[model samples]
Target: MKGMTIIVKTVSSWIKVLVFLFGIYIILFGHLTPGGGFSGGVILAGSYVLLLLAFGREYAEENLPLPIASKLDCIAAFLFIALALLGFIYGAGFFFYNFLQQELMADCNAAGKLVSAGAIPLYNIFIGLKVAASLFLVVLVLSAFRSESDPTEGQE
Candidate 1:
């Protein structure tokens, strides 16, 4: 019902930050590489899951409560939609067209650079946030139900 041993806690304390950072990196560089929003989202979700496992459900909930997770999930999705819709204004009515395609930057269109991708990084970030929150919320709710339904909460 609670967290794991001290070793797990210590290792995870360091690992979670690396994983979270990697998740963001994946999302940011998704367009050029293989990973994308979905993969990065799953990775981000994994970071929260790591926190839950290492710090217990109570701590996880304190760090990312259900209400805040739900609100962030919805907001991220809405922001993604709004951003996509903005392409219509600059993309000639296209759904997800690159509005910032040819603004004459220094070298954004280079083959293998972080800023080469237009709107893709933003999309990945939003989707990653949405998915991370949704996954955390689901896991937390399920764990709550599981804890409540357990037959040995206070029997010991």
Candidate 2:
């Protein structure tokens, strides 16, 4: 299956970019708002899923090939772990010890500013990356089951 109709492809083309950007916004400003890494990550994955649905498996894979997705998955996992390890070396000898200082304002209120969030935003970004890549890969691989089980579903 290549895709649905031109309407779906066009609408999804616009929606996917917006969804991806909104996911980034959520990850970046998570500490300032209610949303966080998990939510943003789901949204990000949804954008790719939208692509997969609108353009089919092959098109989505072409857009984000397996090698690239795998590399991203590894990089994100390593970076997230390395970030946590920093707490042991630089923090109070504990894991995730909030080593980074929160940026305070002149009035002594740093509640919702982007810089005021300390390592939370960085953590959110890493989590978002990892979650997105992980989910994308899972969906991609699970989709394989559909074809393998039927054998003639995608073949004409």
Candidate achieving the largest lDDT: 1
Once fitted onto the true fold, the runs of candidate 1 whose alpha carbons sit more than 4 angstroms away are 103-107
* Pairs of residues at least 3 apart in sequence or in different chains that clash in candidate 1: none
- C-alpha TM-score for every candidate: 0.92, 0.88
Q: Each candidate: RMSD to true structure?
A: 1.7, 2.6
Could you give candidate 1's per-residue lDDT for residues 1-156 as a string of tens digits?
Answer: 679999999999999999999998888888889898888988998999999988899998888888999999999999999989988887789888767754435356786878876777788889989988898888888888988898998795
Residue 114 lDDT, candidate 1, scale 0-100: 81
Q: Candidate 2, residues 2-98: lDDT per residue as tens digits?
A: 7789999999999999999999998888988879898998899889989988899998899889889888888988988888888887776778766
